[model samples]
Every structure is written in structure tokens, then in C-alpha cells.
Target: MALEIPRDRSPDSSLWLLRDGYQFIEKRARRYGTDIFDTRLLLQRTVCMTGAEAARAFYEHEALQRTGAGPARVQRTLFGQGGVQGLDGAEHRQRKQMFMSLMTPEAIQRLADFSAEQWQARAASWAAAERVVLLDEAEELLCRAVCAWSGIPLPEHEVATRTRDLVLMFESAASVGVKHWQGRLARRRGEAWVADLVRRTRTGELSQGPGQALATIAGHREPDGRLLDERVAAVELLSVLRPTVAVSRFIVFVALALQSSAGSRAKLEAGDLDPEWFVHEVRRFYPFFPFVVARAGEDFEWGGYRIPSGERVLLDLYGTNHDARWWPQPGRFQPERFRDWTGDPFTLIPQGGGDHYAGHRCAGEWVTIALMKTALAFLTTSIRYDVPAQDLRVSLSRIPAAPSSGFVMSNVHRA
Candidate 1:
């Protein structure tokens, strides 16, 4: 079937896709076949693709590049323009290497302990109040933890304010209308705030702390002899901060799952929280980066459709996560699927797949799993989620999908 551009300029279809995107992408792919529909955008000329092959191909395409105008526009606005994600070739590899050192297992283990300490303190306060918004509370906890680690010295009010602003920047960047402009403004403000922090740290004015590992590494040289300059270092730090802000959202989503699912809560209560199992399931089911945008680098034909060079392609992560061909009972949340299936690691990529051929995957996948495991272990065994009516709905289009009301919980009795 030939790829046909939608003649209707109405963005309702696209807007609807953005709202409940997973289901929309699934239904569309089923109707039009993964080959065609997966590459067709509902609202614009941008191509939307899914399936293992398309995803693999996009990441593997040599002519294709991630640090293009489309991505640069958003990344610069959201994560400072010229960081690793915005660079191509040797520059991108060099910057990525500089940041990778901070993600070492040893470093993550230390951070895990620190994160648990903060979680414990925050959980105590929530228990005292006997009620708290999961979203707000989680963001606060993560921001504080990140600040403590990064030596950012942000006050409670500033953390709250800046976090809200960053979240807005992400939302605006993802949405349509005047949102792009609004996102740009937020990005500018956020970049300036973070850049100043980086400057302070460099001059030794900001004391080195537990979370300052990334900043420290930013100043280090890679094995390949690549070093990150101050501006690039600042952007990399913001990249880390972006994920730090989102991790809490993912944590709350998992908590809500435990509350709502039949045996899930009971499992937590029983102290049977398997770190590997639960974390994998949560990532598989959650809408983290529902849609990843990429621009075609060269004219190519895949699945019979011709993608012109420089055209933007949006890969539906949510759609692929639920692709029946790749995952059986794709809609259901099952961690057991990964228990014995040790075949190809590429088959299941909650954090993405491949090396350079795969894509620029999340570096913190291991750390995220470890942190989530630690959080769940504490919450299930030590703290109790007592929200009267827990809400688990996700803002699908949001980059790191945060819950509408955040995960509100209370009742701190020992499990």
C-alpha cells in the first residue's frame, strides 16, 4: 500500500493520538498494517513507525542522524541545544563517553543508598501527614536527592518552582499550538538556572557532594580522549536532571499498579518484591517516552514505503511495547515473560535496544531499575500506600508520563 498523506489538516486525530496514544497507534497499525500505518502521522507529514524491524532500522540507519534540526530544536529548548544528543559523529560519541563514567555500577550503588535515605525521610513526613500527592511528593524527593548529589543548593521553594517549570517545558515541547513558544521560554529559563549552577560547581564555589558525580565526570577525559567543555557539561547535567525528574513519575506509576492490581499489592505486602521482575514489568507497562522522534537522514524504502531524506519520523515506543508480534498479550503487565526468555536482549528493550545500531538508549536503565527496586522494597515492607482511590491514568503524550493527580498515598503503618 502506498503511504498517503492525510489531506485533512485537522489535528484532532493527532491530538487524540497524543492523549491516548498507545491505543490509537495500536488500532491504526492493526487497520493499516504495521508497514504503512506505523510510518504515517495522523496530524502532520511526520512519519510514525513501530514494530521491531522499523525501530531497529531507524536506529541502524547510517545516513540517519539524531542530532538534526528537529531534535536540536526540542533538545536545545529542553536540555540546552548543543549537548550530546544534539551532536553527531565523533562529537556525540565523545560526549556520551564522558557521561557514561558517572553511571558506573559502583557509583549507582552509592547513589542507591543515598536515594533510599531520602525516600525514607520523605516517607516519614508523608506518614505524618497521612496523605500526600504522589506526583508532587515524588518530584520533590527526586529534586532534593538530585540537588544533594549535584551540589545545586536549591532551596525547597526553588526546587519546587524549577521542577514545575521543567515539567511545563517538557509538556509544552510535546504539545501543539503556542506551546512550542512557551516551552522555549521555559527551556531558556531552565538552561540559565542549570548553567549558573554548573558555573558555580566549576569554580569550586559549589561544594562537591554525593550527587555531583556527573559534574565531576564532565570535567574528566574519556578513554577516547574526549572531554566535555563547560557548556556541553551543563547540558549533560540537565540531561541527568531531566531523567531524575521523570524517575519519580515512573515510581508513582508502579506504586499505583501495586495498589490497583489484584495480587500486585499483596505481593508487595508479602515482601516478595523481586527487583528484576517488578522493575522490568513497570518499564514495559509504563509510558516512558511514548514516542521517540527521529529525522530520516537519507531517502530510503522500508516496508515498501519511501521515506524522503530529512523527513521526521516518530517511533511509537508505546505501540512497539504493545506490539502483539513482539510481546504476547501485549496489553497485560507480565514480568514473567522476561524470566526465562534469555534469547536476544533486543527483543525486549524497555530502555531501548542495540549499540550504535540500536539507538541512543537511556544510560540510567540499570540505575533506574535498582532505584525502583530499592524504593519498592522500602514502600512495600516499611511504608504503606493508603490513598482512598488511587488514580493510575497517564498523560500519554508527556515525555516522561506523569500521573494526572500524581500518586497520592498515606497511612504509614509498617507493612
Candidate 2:
């Protein structure tokens, strides 16, 4: 028995999505009293769904494929062309393994250690300043840390220029006009910058330490025994560098959560709560990635509705994280929820869901957690600062939202 999915009844909902932002899918889900619905976005029919079960079907069942699913704007900006984000099946797995190889426990700890060093060093400079915007400072800090960890040299003079380009890539991913064009330009420059590095590394003009991401990606060959196109290699490298810089947004949220959530900072300061728990809550409670896109891999029936092959499906990451069925009192910020966490990948997917190796779950998730925990400990225990009265509001209408004032801190000093 085929059932018709609830439809948005509009010829196009792209404007609505831009206007509604993070809540667009969930708002309609609530109104229709169903977890699944159909809509027209950008003049094409699309299916949107939320909650744990839908995610299981989307990821685990292999009901969707990522290739050609991402928007042209996203490909030109956020993801870049021919990167792993756009691959499928064997090609994706091979590329993904190359990424996961850099995520071993030792490698992750190395990144965290590098992050802590950056924080300590930056905090020293912040102490001398009258005020510091955390978002700006954190982006630069992460940009430096990731570059050093990845074996990419970041000369002192180019830090600001490189960081701004990386920031623009994500910031303008959902914007229009000038900002959108800026994102495209950034991607172009970023790719060219890394492609040159790839060329140099291949020709021995550049040397990298063993296991360094730059060297590994440059030397990696496809299953077909061909080297990645130099441009594609650059995209993969930026795939590493860009996302690491984007973690700065989460770092800002760590600061905001400590400021807003009563007694939360006290627990961290008093050693009553683990920084890991706080970091998890910040990811689940805040908005970073709103949703991920894919095309149905094959015709299938799910939730009493028939989904046709080639149909565009958006599995709502933000909405699923806040789904009441999986998260009790899902609207509230609670770090304690993870204390006895079942470790269900589908439920708390701030990145994406499912098995990291076999599926599309983000390979950098462990790195994000390690870096966020480091930042949390630094903010709560390693430093003392005053949050000046300013706009800390995070607007959901903004894709990849952050505080309006970038969470300013004044009179900073080491604790």
C-alpha cells in the first residue's frame, strides 16, 4: 500500500529554506505530524526526514548515494569538486581510508596537544589586549595548529590571508550575492594554493615527515592505480584544512555555553564534570552543520511512502539531534545525557551518522571532539576572563551560526 508523502505545496521552497534556515525541515515535520515529508526546493522535488530511524535507513541501508547530490554552489564552494564528499562505493571507501589513517589515537592526541599549545600561546597575547573576539582568534589558532600538524608550512605573514580564505569557504556556503561569490573565489584560491603544494611534494621540491597528511594525500593512488588529479589532491587537502578551521565555530560555542548555562562552568571548574561531556552537549545543543544531502540510491519504500530512485533526500542533522524520541527533553542543554550514552551514531550526529569506515560518517569527528575538549578545558580551567555585555545571540536563520559579537572577552589572563 503506497502512501503519499506530505507535500509543501509550493513550486519552490529555496527561499523558504534560506529564510527559515535550520528549522525549515523540523518545523514542517511538526506541522504535518510526521517525521517525513516531500517538498520542492530549487524547483526540484525533494524529500526531507528526521529522527533516528530515518537516519538508520538513510545511512546504514545504503539507500542514498552522495555523487551528484550536492548542489553546484556547494561543490564550487564548501566541498570543492572531485573530493571524497562527492564519491560513492569503492572510490569513496578508498579515499575515506586515506583520511581515517590520519585519525589514529596517537595522531589525534598530537593534534590536541598542538591545539592546547596554540591556546596557551594565544591567551598570552590576549592578556595584553583590551578585548579579543574569540571567533577571529580561534580561527587563526586552529588554522596554524592544523597546518603544523598536517605538515603544511604556515609562514607568519600568510596566516591571516590563509585563515580568511578558509573562513570564507564555509561562511559563504549558504549566502547570496557578494558573499556567495566570495566563497567561490576562496575555493579557487585555496585549491590553487594546495595544488601547488601537491605538485611540489610530488617533485621532491617540498619534504614532509612520514605519515604527514600532505605527503600521504599526495602519494595516495586510486584503486585503479592512478594518482589523484593534482587539483583533486588539493581539494582533499583543503577538505582536511577547511574543516579544521571551521571547528573554530564549535570553540566559540564552547565559550558561549559556559557563559549561558548556569552552574555548567562551575562543574567543569570544580572537576565535577568531564570536559568531554560539555563538548558533546555543545555539539548537540548548538547549530553547526544543519543537514546533509544525497540522492536515493535506488527505489525504496520507507515510513509507508515510496521514494523513487534519483530523488534528492536531506537527512536533517540538527533536527535529528533534537528529536525528542531519541533525546529526552531534547530542547534543553544537558551534558549529563552522554554520561551513559549508548553511542548510537545515528542519534547524535552533529557531523553525519553511521559507521565511519563503511559509511559516510565524517572522518574528522574524532579530531573535532579532541579539539573541542581541549578548548573547553582551556576556557574553564586554564584561563579567566570577563564576558563583556554584548549580543551573544546565535541566529538559527544563519547557516553555521555563531554569536553575533563573536563572544568577546576582556581582561584575560592565565588561571
State each model's C-alpha RMSD to the native.
3.7, 0.9
Pairs clashing within candidate 1: 38-48, 38-49, 76-81, 134-407, 135-406, 149-211, 149-212
Identify the leading candidate in terms of TM-score: 2
List model 1 lDDT by residue over 250-340, tens digit each. 7886786776675866765665545577677788787766656667678877766777787777666677777778789977877667666
lDDT of 2 by residue, 166-226 (tens): 9999999998899999999999999999999999999999999978899999999999899
Off by over 4 Å in 2: none
Ten-residue stretch with the least lDDT total in model 1? 3-12
Q: What lDDT score is found at residue 335 in candidate 1?
A: 64
For every model shown, the clashing-pair count is: 7, 0
Judge candidate 1 against the unseen true structure and give its global Cα lDDT, from 0 to 1: 0.66
RMSD of 2: 0.9
